[model samples]
Target: MDKITIQNLEVYANHGVFPEETALGQKFLVCAELWTEIRTAGRTDDLEYSINYGTVCQEITRFMKEHTSRLIEAVAEQLAEYLLQTLPLLKGITLEIKKPWAPVGLPLDTVSVKIERCWHRAYVAFGSNMGDRRSHIDSGIQVLRDDPAIRVGSISDMIVTEPYGGVEQEDFLNGCLELETLLTPMELLAVLQKAEQKENRERLVHWGPRTLDMDLLFYDDEVLEEPELAVPHPEIPKRRFVLEPLSQIAPYKMHPVLKKRVKELLEELSDRE
Candidate 1:
C-alpha cells in the first residue's frame, strides 16, 4: 500500500475530562496515514485518482471539533470509522490524537492516543427454519443493510436443506451474502447477534430451529477462535446447506485452512454422499 502522511496537524477542540478543559478549548495535534495505492494518482497526475489531503485535513479538523469525548481513544476510534465510511478511496488509516493540554498538575510533554483501522471483507451465512422462512431471511438481510457501516454485497439465492446436528426440525432456508465492513471480527459478531436477537432467535437447542440464524463464515481469510465466536465457521465443509448458497455468490472463494474453493468443497461433500 502506498502512503500519504499528514503530520501533526493542529486543531483547537474541547475534548477532556475536566469541565475547565471544555470551557476553555485547547490545541490538539493530529496525525494521519492514509493507506492506498497511489500509483494511479501519480501516473495520471489527477487529483480525482487520489484522496485529497487538504479535504481530509479539513474533515478531520471539523470532525474533531464537532464531536466531544472525554477520552482521546474514543476520538481516534470514532474518527477512524467516520473517515473510512465517508471516503471511498481510502483503504485504511493510522490516526494519532495528541492532547498536550492535560492538567496533571505536573509538567508533562504530551498525552496521546493512536489507532489503526480499516475496512474488512466478510462473508456471512443466513438461515431460518421456523415459520415464514424466506421472510425471516429477507427481513434479517434488510436489517443488516440498514446499517451504513455495513456494505452488503452479493446475496445468494435461498435454498432449502434438511436439518443438521441430528435434531428433528423443519427444513431450513439457507443463504449467504458478502459484505464490506469497517467492523472488527468481534464487533461484526456482536452486530450479527443483535440482529438475530431482533428476530427472536433462541439457542435452546443446538441447530434445532430458529426464526433467523446468522453465521460469520469468513472475515478476510482470517482464522480466529474465542469462547463465543469462530472464523471460517469451523464446520463449513460439512454443511452443504451453507456451501450451495455460498457457491452462488462466491464459488471460488477459498477456505484458508482447507485451501479449497467453495465449489470444490461442495463437490467433495456431494461425492461422499
Candidate 2:
C-alpha cells in the first residue's frame, strides 16, 4: 500500500471534559496516514489518480472547525470515518489526535488517541424457511446494498435445502454473500441482528421456521470464540449450503483454522455425504 502522511495539522477546536475547555477553546494537532494505491498517480503525475494531500488538509481544517465534540476520541473516530467515506481511493486510515494543552496540571508531552481503521472482507449466510422466503432474502440484500461501507461482491443462487436440525420445518432457501465492509466483526453482527429483527426473527423455537435468517459465516479468515459470536461460523465447513455459496465467490480462500481452501473442503464434505 502507498502512504500519504499528513502530520501535526493545527486546529482550534473546543473539545475536552471540562466546561471551560469548550468555552475557552483549545488547540489540537492531528496526524493522518492515508493508505491507497499510488502506482498510477506516480506514473501519470496526475492528482486524479492519487489522493490529493492538499484537499485532505483543507478537509481536516474545515471539519475540525465545523464539528466540535466533547472528546478528541469522538473527533478522531468521526474524522477517520469521514476521510474513508470521502476519499474513494483510500483503503485505510491511521489517525492520531493530539491534545497538547490538556489541563492535566503536570509536565507532560501530549495526550492523544490513535486508531487504525480499514475495510474487511466478510461472508454472510442467508436463509429463510417461513413465508415469503425469497422476499426476505431480497430485503436483506437491499439493506446491505443501501449501506455505504458495505459493498456486495457476489451472491450465490438460492438453493433449497432440507432442514438440518431435528426440529421439523419447511425447506429453507439458503445462499452465501461476499461483502467488503468497513465494519468490525462485532459491528457487522449488529447489522445482521438488526436486519433479522426487522424481519421479526424470534428465538422461540430453536431452528424453527423464520421470516429471515442471517448469520456471519466468516470474517477475513478470522477465528474468534466469544460469548455472543463465533467466527468462521463453527459448522460452515460441514454445511454444503454454506460452502456452495462461499465457493462461488471465494473458491480458493483458505480457512484460517482448517488450513483448507473452501472449494477443497466443500469437495471433501460432498465425498463423505
Alpha-carbon TM-score of each model against the true structure: 0.94, 0.94
Q: Write the per-residue lDDT of candidate 1 for residues 1-273, one digit (tens) a residue.
A: 998999999999988889988888899999999998889999999999999999999999999899998888998999999999899899999999998888889999999999999889999999999989988888888877888789999999888899989999899889999999988889888889888888889989887899999999999999998999989899899999999999999999999999999999999999999
**Clashing residue pairs for model 2:** none
Question: Each model's C-alpha lDDT?
Answer: 0.92, 0.89
lDDT tens per residue, model 2, 1-273 = 889999999988888889999888999999999999999999999989999999999999899888889888899989988888788898999999999999999999999999998878899999999999999898888888888878888898899999887789899999998998999889889888888888888889887888888999889978999999999889887899889878888898888998999999999999999
Tell me how candidate 2 scores on lDDT: 0.89
Runs in model 2 deviating more than 4 A are none
Query: Relative to the unseen true structure, what is the C-alpha lDDT of residue 111 in candidate 1, on a scale of 0 to 100?
Result: 93
In terms of lDDT, model 1 sits at: 0.92
